[model samples]
Target: MSSHVAPDDQATSGLDRRGELREFLRSRRARLRPEDVGLPSYGRRRVPGLRREELAQLAGVSYAYYARLEQGYGETMSAEVLDAVARALRLSEEEREHLVRLAQPERQGTPQAAPPPQRLRPSVQHLLDGLGVPAYVVSRRLDILGWNRLAATVFGDWAQLTPEERNTARLIFLSPEARDRFADPERTALTAAGALRMNAGKSPEDSYLSSLIEELSQKSEEFRRLWARHEVSCGTVGDIVRMRHPLVGEFDLVHESMALRGGAPMRLVTYHAEPGSRSEEALRMLASWELEPRR
Candidate 1:
């Protein structure tokens, strides 16, 4: 579980963090079956795992009240109620802390002021160069901070855009050109939007994030629908991206993201083809094209 803060009611404010927390907790609980958490699999259960009534019983709350809480209609729950819910769900220490953080926003101070603008370190740049693949570093806000030659070749149009326009989520949702570039545009868009949703919960006050969400909501109906789904995914490792590059046609590549140790606002992303596949040939071609000196 990631950290989350309470949301302010102001329009200028970002996501309602408490709302996010309630939704997250509810979603997590809804997925568990009784057998999943060592509960007895007694008679024909109307629903899998613990029903709302059973959960309410365990937490010492009325079913109506627990339903209200899950619906985000009940605020001001006592710490005792939260603890009971935590125990019922078998929450770990970290998850319990996260729940408390969400329930009691006043306890945590305002998020730290946005960090200063920083560039990738020379050593990190060199490390990317050595990888000799389509690689780049991005901020939590999906800003492209730096990239090697192969990345420039693969995401050239995106890389050439201004800082305000370089966001991956924005490209997936707002740009028709970007939408057409992916083999399965809908899946690609949903995945990108879901990743952004995850980031929103992690850093609710990010100005860039707020701007990106506003832009997408206004510009793309598809994005708006997907955003409302509240899906969250961290594309940290082993995620596959299917691309229909104008130059390379079609190829499937595995993507991985690694946080740079002690480096603020930078995560390295790299892509590679599965072994003994046509994607390998496509990657080699991409590299050759990248290696050529430009005018």
Candidate 2:
């Protein structure tokens, strides 16, 4: 028997989500100080961050062309240019992959019927349970799929919120409480924006993502300014996060992510510390607190 495929399959399967790439590049460029990259500060500039002309010069592109690219022009951007831009922005390897994915999303063999629900597999869930560490799975869209009890405790009230409200990016920019929760609110806010920039490139047509950007832009002037800068960062693995929990007080945690197979909507995230460290002691206290029954 012969099988027939839908005519629109190719378009759907091979869709390119370059809008995110533009956003990511812009965001990264916005955060850098002129002196950070060995350029002398000429004089008092109106913008606190790097100017577009300075970024273009560093990335070896014309200011007008760079503006067009960040504005989602989707012109033919060469790999060489992409490389230069990544270098100028000091993008990590993972961040570079995120850039490539946004610039050229891989055409899947089959089109997905719907966006994958954020979920963790049984095996991964079991692994999380066994590790007894603060762990969770986050989707490419920054959805918190599944998290351990310790994760719930460590993240405080934020973790207890409904999945719709638990989004890190939304909470960081849209919720004032989140800003208070983090010790370094400004860094947290910028990092969340950068991650969102990376995601924008991969799923440009996603309404939820667009809605998030709109909400943040309206609610937070700082978010609006950072969003316009269009920086991107792949926060997938090995990032240090310092948080001030209402219960645990304050602790430093290492955030690590491992990819799952079979297009799983989840990536494994675990928080741990060096052996016999103060963080380990904090983890023990956290675990004890989690075991106690809630009032």
Q: Give candidate 1's TM-score.
A: 0.73
C-alpha local distance difference test of each model: 0.68, 0.65
Candidate 2 residues lying further than 4 Å off, grouped into runs, are: 1-77, 84-91, 94-119, 157-160, 176-179, 291-295
In model 1, the clashing pairs are: 33-49, 34-49
Candidate 1 lDDT at 167 equals 70
Q: Write the per-residue lDDT of candidate 2 for residues 190-232, one digit (tens) a residue.
A: 8777776555555555555656666666667787666555556
How far in Å is the alpha carbon of 178 misplaced in model 2?
A: 4.2
Look at candidate 1 and tell me the lDDT of residue 160: 55
Candidates in order, TM-scores: namely 0.73, 0.70
Best by lDDT: 1
Q: TM-score of the candidate numbered 2?
A: 0.70
Candidate 2's displacement at residue 147, Å, is: 0.9
Local distance difference test, candidate 2: 0.65
